[model samples]
Target: MIDAAEHRVVDCDWHYQDSFTDIVEYMEEPWKTKYEKSNWDAAGVKQNLSSFFPTSTGDRQAYGKIEREHSNYPDKAETPDRVREGMEFLDVDQSIQISHLALAMGGVQTDDERTQAFAKAHIEYMLEEVLDPDDGVYGLAPLPYSDIETSLEILDRVENEPAIKGACFITAGANPPLGNRKYDPLYKRCEEIGYPVVFHTGGSGLDDYVRAGYQEMLETHTLGFLESNMSQLVSVTCQGVPEKFPDLDIVFMESGVTYVPGLISRLEEEYLKRPEEAPLLEKRPSEYITDYYFGTQPLEVSASPDLLELCFDMLGTDRLLYASDYPHWDFDSPSTITDLPFISDEERKAILAGNAVEVFDL
Candidate 1:
């Protein structure tokens, strides 16, 4: 049995690679042919996308090397050595890793072969490297949102796998809005299999945070979280997904909890004003919102201590989880959060591992 004290920390949000080549390996012959002929090279795509994030001064070259190596060894990111290193750095017992690039692959245009190739590659990588490991590392499987049948098929394949905790769908893109009935089948499958559905911010391709004509990476990264978090909330409420999948657990990743109170308040107010248009809910919108979970990181230190109390008061403590967002620039060190000011020691322990233990059934 895993000791709660020794194996207590569970990072709710960590990342893994989305190497195109790795994804392409599992593609059918036709898809592979299409991807090989595509104009956009994998390296170019990654470089262009990285420009939107804040990179360290000397890290650009190192990132280039890392990306290149990953492009070659698609499984490199999931290697045990790398996972262990990350766990040590964050002082966490286990990691629930989501892949931004892999999720993006689901949005790639399926009319062409490249899209098919991308899906096959991503699914194969998730199964072989990310989810098949016996180590403590856990994975969020990517779904091919472009094709619901395929997405459901993939879910069916991975849901029973012990290493896989849930399916990850991006907050934005060609994928249908979260509230659409089209997603009901997927949600139903998740509910049947007892796996959560996770929505991660970013990978919109067009950086919403990038100011027009302004190229500062820092500005883009900072503003990106705001846009992403708002979109996530909107997707859940405006799209009416919660009403459709009342039993399904949804996790909002990387987005902080500070905005949740205001969002839930607004949702409740709107529900009260327009009960005719929104008739599916059994309780107040805030009550439903409280049933969902939010993974926090780089927590707003100035206000989070008090905000933590506010969130528990409003959303309940079980609805909030801790995440380190490890290896990223804004990554929060585990030790730093171990003694967060204002929060009781018991609350801190719940955030660190107890909540995750219940959520993931770890």
Candidate 2:
């Protein structure tokens, strides 16, 4: 059992493993053929390593790290024992493990059969690792973005699974904006079932600016969050998805909160410039943003405390959730965030646990 003190803190953003081997292991036989046809062998591994760890010496060192860390599943990195260690380190009560590969890879094949199979495999893996009989772990289900009908069906299959709290989608990489009419069926299903939709940045199989070149790594990693959030917010607001499904709750994960104030201000500015474009909005763009949820990391905690106070004051306690982003190179350690010089006890409590309870209904 989780300690009562620890149980009260909810980690809003965390990641699950997607080892290269796991993908090869879980693929269906026919799909395995397709996967193998792609460059998933040694050459593919080398290419991935080169891209993620570009420096010559750094890449060599990182190859060992990646192989050591990712070659096995339920290994030290993903074991419940290791997770408990992290929970203890963070003083967190419960954690939601969002799948990095599952969210990154949407619509493996455009056809319905392949997409459904892919989605099912992902859900099954999530259930096996994080959900099955585990007391404190929860999961966000991955939908087949390739086909809406299958996506809705997958939602229906997992909606009642107690271990599943939400559905996750790629922040980018889907054909149209998330608010596009094609996705309304999925949103409507989520609303009816009362599951929040989580949009995680850095999708798989994407060839965006970030994935294109080495120079874009710094800029890509920084700007990806802003770009995806802006695109999603604008798409949902301007396209009337919120109006269509007011009860649907969406959380933007891994994107820091510093730029949000500016985004909201800019959105309001654009709304005023062309009111007709956003006729469905009942108030300013910031109002809807305040209604939505955001997960906070250590970097976001670096924003001026005064500005942070103002933004949270407007967004209210329920709109922000705490996330440690554990195990990644950029993982935010709990101590670092909790010890930020300017944050108050009350705000710390809220960001660490209080807000997540309300947002996740834990």
Candidate 3:
């Protein structure tokens, strides 16, 4: 087992997936009955989520990567014992249990009520099976991005659950981006409770741009997943989210690092020219970007060491968090991320664990 007493290593973007049937076992009362009876709204929402992110696929022609976590029923990937075993194997201290079902919910065109019900059921399962009993595991509370009130209610219900360290919502399908007035209540509440609002990777934003724009699955999958973060990060920094909730810590996960510096430079130049348009911004856009934390996954291997060093510098050495994207085929080992020759030991340690400890307030 990895000795937590000596070194701290937190996998910031660990994932858990389930089919629609697996989720029903965790639901209570009305939600349970709805799933059992196949209530059109609730059942339909669950079906879509399950189909979108299954743990295993029969397609041999499946995209580039095919490796996935073992899918033993009951003792599946996200179970407490399984997580403990995974951390031990990976030499990690803990992992933030992010919901794959919740990630799919962001882009689905579903009723607000139904989505909220699904979100609650998903979180219920996460708390029971993956988070509550495991000290080495932390959770991100899934949010129904379609309805703010229901999301708030989920947070209220899970407030005393200390294992839930952050709130997970997707901005991929968000029309107004995430900085609009509609999401103010959530930002405010998260700030009050000292929880960081994490914007994880999701897909099919704004009329399914990726699918419509690209022909090949490889083409769409590669670019589609990362584009949403760029747009939303711009919206949050440029639209003055930081100014309104100064202490609200935000995270961008699964997105690569190159675009961050490019976008910040664009925003910086724009700020110098059009300061009046975005008056809510207190400092330059890059400073706000610095205040946020980002995940190091799908690492920018194409970049030379010098370029990687420059990107890390722009990102602020302490701001990047290391993630394995574990159990997925593309998962980077903690060593692969930390073993880089260009970075110092302290920088690698910060990326591996110290930064996550501060960002999640673990």
Candidate 4:
């Protein structure tokens, strides 16, 4: 248990999700029975196809390594009481409860019905058990981009739920990028309704390019999370998703902040050369990035802290929210951020809590 020096700490991203069957128990259909009756999300019942392609759940994968070796089981570790204990230890005044297992299964399901049921059931369980406390554990609803109607319905259901703050669409496959016109409805609705979408992705739902010739979990874990977020980051900015929905605020989770400056620079370079292509873009690509926030987990540990120093100086103190990536193997905490010699006390306080309160309206 680490003391937060009495600062108002806001953990922007926290995972409190469990195994598939845990969410299945909340389902109201044949899907619930199917999960309980037959082992779903397990070996043989449903194999981890992509891991075989490179590294997956059943094999030497990033997440499986965390569970098998690190002892951080998503379902078992993430409970209201358990999370409360973590929050207490970290002195987290507010945190956003984001889903994982269900979203990871977004496109993996051979049966769409199971996917739909799992999505709804996961939301139901989070709303009741994990996110129901209303004790600063803010619910960030997971909206499956693949299931538009169900996603919309879930959004409408939680539109006014007090503790419900934002929404999320997992980014694994490039099939339906965030910039796709089909996802316009979800984005438009979130903008109108004032729900910030905390976009997250990694390991499981990856594009074909990611797994090509890939061999080890280390390779994927090190790069997979960044690759997934980078695609969405490029899509939303270049396609002018931020400009179209000016109110939308997206917090890119897990992917470190160091890459953002470079990505923005490249985007600006392309934008300047071909401004005519993205007519909807109102300002420099970097400006739109400020409209978004970022989680500080897997904190950048460079031989020279100057790189991390440079990234923060470039991005400023507004949108970099503190995140522990709690219950995961690569969790970051107060010491990680606070001990950064480059971060001034003012900026440290802002990252710790100030920025999150304003962004999430906590």
Candidate 5:
């Protein structure tokens, strides 16, 4: 077995609760006052109208399909101390924290100004309240996806903060796709600042898949992540995002690694048939894909080891980063990678730590 003690294990993708109640306090005048006054409470229930996140899980908890039990200790991973304890338990040296509530910010929030305000409040809350680079906890600045100018501004705002590692582009319900020219400026800004643009997926039960009449939350939750990232992969690759910003680093989170090899093969097959369509791409789609990084949370470990080993070989072992997705229902532990019989000790160490260090410049 690969020894977790031998490496400064880095979790490239982890999530924490950015509750609206707490984030609202950091909002500016109009929004703060508006949210506070509009926030409603009842005998045994409460709701925040200003919450940017949609109610994606629906009535699963009400029916006992899911349980929300209280923990003996801090379980949200929302504070620096809680995060440090989590890292210790998982044998992780460093972690890049994503927001559990804000993961759907881009897809769910349509109001441009509200999106900007929420993004700002989230970054402010994380920077001031949660993030502690010295304690091995770091975060990505959540960007307002629709507002390019504000996104660029946020990038500049967090440029000097040591705990702010990169800009997070939520991809759950990205309209016009990520490869469009609308996102080019933000991508360019990321490249200029040496910050990788990490695309994080979210549950699609609230809007996209539901609107299409998909009743089951399980169906949407299972397929939503894969579909969202696959859509962007096609857009980013075909539109030559890598070519346009050669130095820019890209990372896709939440989705498992299995779809990558299949998607790349499909893209290459189509690219060969019609090279005229994607004129900007100088190499095969798979070739450019190998340059990007992917987080391995919700990793499909139930699959056959031989199949996984083949997938890893196709994608290159160095491109994979171990992500715990801790504090969530389906989080992976360090043993998930360490116990893999196919990967050698060195490769396991690289996946668990080394690749993340190089990807995020840790």
Candidate 6:
């Protein structure tokens, strides 16, 4: 059995309830003025009107169907002090705070300039108010996927901040797929700056998944992360993204681990028969996959330990980073990995904090 007390924990996928109402002050003109004047409390408007991202009508916490200790202060991780308090409760040594409201950046339905403005404002707020690498609260700057130029500019702006670790790309509703040539400049810039690109999936964009016949949140929530990550996994590998940007570190978050083995096996089989289609890839699809890292949030605790052990062997234990996805109802705790009988003490330490320290350059 692993000694839980001695293990150092690092949460790679922590979230704060971000609201435009709070960051509105960070936003720039015309739109800022328009946002201030907009009646967010209007009747029939979605309860999450302060958010720039589309609001799904999923009843997560409504009417007390679900409950958390800090339910009232949903944005408990909004400040450095608050973030530390939450971390202390979970017994985490460090946390990389991902955006809650900013997760839907790819699904922002507006002009490119407006979308870019929101991205810039969000990063500015994070850097000024929340991000504190010294205090163990780090963050990723969200990028406007549709605007490559603006995305590059955001990278340049935050290049010097110790607390700003990487650039986050919202995977839902992302057009041109990540492997397309249009995204090369962004990928190249991230590699040059020695920052990993984190693809964080969101469940708010139900319409995107609705086309696949998922009407309820349970259906969409269960499969949304898998679908988006799987699509990008195939897209990135088939198009030789890893081949082109060899130094760039890529991470897929929120999706659970079980889908990986089956998907990679199928992808390899297809790639074997069609090598000509992907000229740049010198290795099999699964080989390039090993180079990328994945978060262990929603880690699928229900699966048998023996089955999970096979997954750990195939994917390599070092590639998995422990993520709590905290504040959200389904968040995992450090004990999830600490109590696992399959992983060795050394492997447990790596997943809890060691791998994150190397991955985020902490």
- For each candidate in the order shown, give its overall lDDT on alpha carbons: 0.64, 0.64, 0.72, 0.72, 0.79, 0.79
The lDDT, on a scale of 0 to 1, for candidate 2 is 0.64
For 1-362, candidate 2 gives per-residue lDDT tens digits of 22325436778776765433344446577765654555444422333332221211122123345443323322323544566666676676688877655544542434335545556766776676555425577777777666787788788888878878888886655667777788888898989888888877653433343345434334555665567666776787777777789999878777777777777788888888998877777777777777888877635666677887676667665577778776554567555446655556666677777877665666
TM per candidate? 0.81, 0.81, 0.86, 0.87, 0.91, 0.93
List residue ranges in candidate 5 displaced over 4 A. 40-52, 57-77, 204-207
**For model 6, how big is the CA root-mean-square deviation?**
2.5
Residue pairs clashing, model 1? 23-121, 179-239
Which residue segments of model 4 deviate by more than 4 Å?
1-3, 40-70, 74-77, 106-111, 205-209
Clashing residue pairs, candidate 4? 18-75, 51-55, 51-56, 172-205
Estimate, for each residue in 1-362, the C-alpha lDDT of model 6 and write its tens digit. 56545667889998866666666678899868766666544321234454455755365564466676744334232555667888888888788888777766656656747678777887888888888777888889888878888999999999888998888887877777878899899999999999999988876576456474556667777777788888888888889989999998999898878888989989888888888999999988898887788898898888988888888888878999999988777789888898888888899999888888898999
Error of model 3, residue 345, in angstroms: 0.9
How does candidate 3 score on lDDT?
0.72
Clashing pairs in 2: 6-93, 7-93, 104-204
Could you tell me which residue pairs clash in candidate 5? none
- Which parts of model 1 are misplaced by more than 4 Å? 1-7, 34-80, 103-116, 130-133, 206-214
Backbone N/Cα/C clashes per model = 2, 3, 0, 4, 0, 0
Residues forming the 10-long window of minimal summed lDDT in candidate 2: 52-61
* lDDT for predicted candidate 5 compared with the true structure: 0.79
- TM for candidate 5 is 0.91
Q: Per-residue lDDT tens digits of candidate 4, residues 1-362?
A: 22376778988888764555567678877766766766344421243443211224323325454553333453243456777877877778788877656446544635356666766777777777777535888878777667778889988988888778888777666466777778888998898788888778655744333555666656666677777788898888778888778778778888878888888888888888988887778888788876778887777876368888878877776778888877666778777777878767888888898988887888
Better of 1 and 3 by lDDT: 3
Kindly provide the TM-score of model 2 when superposed on the true structure, using C-alpha atoms: 0.81
Best by TM-score: 6
* Model 6 error, position 291 (Å): 1.6
Q: Rank the candidates by lDDT, best first.
A: 6, 5, 3, 4, 2, 1
Q: Weakest 10 consecutive residues, lDDT, candidate 4?
A: 51-60
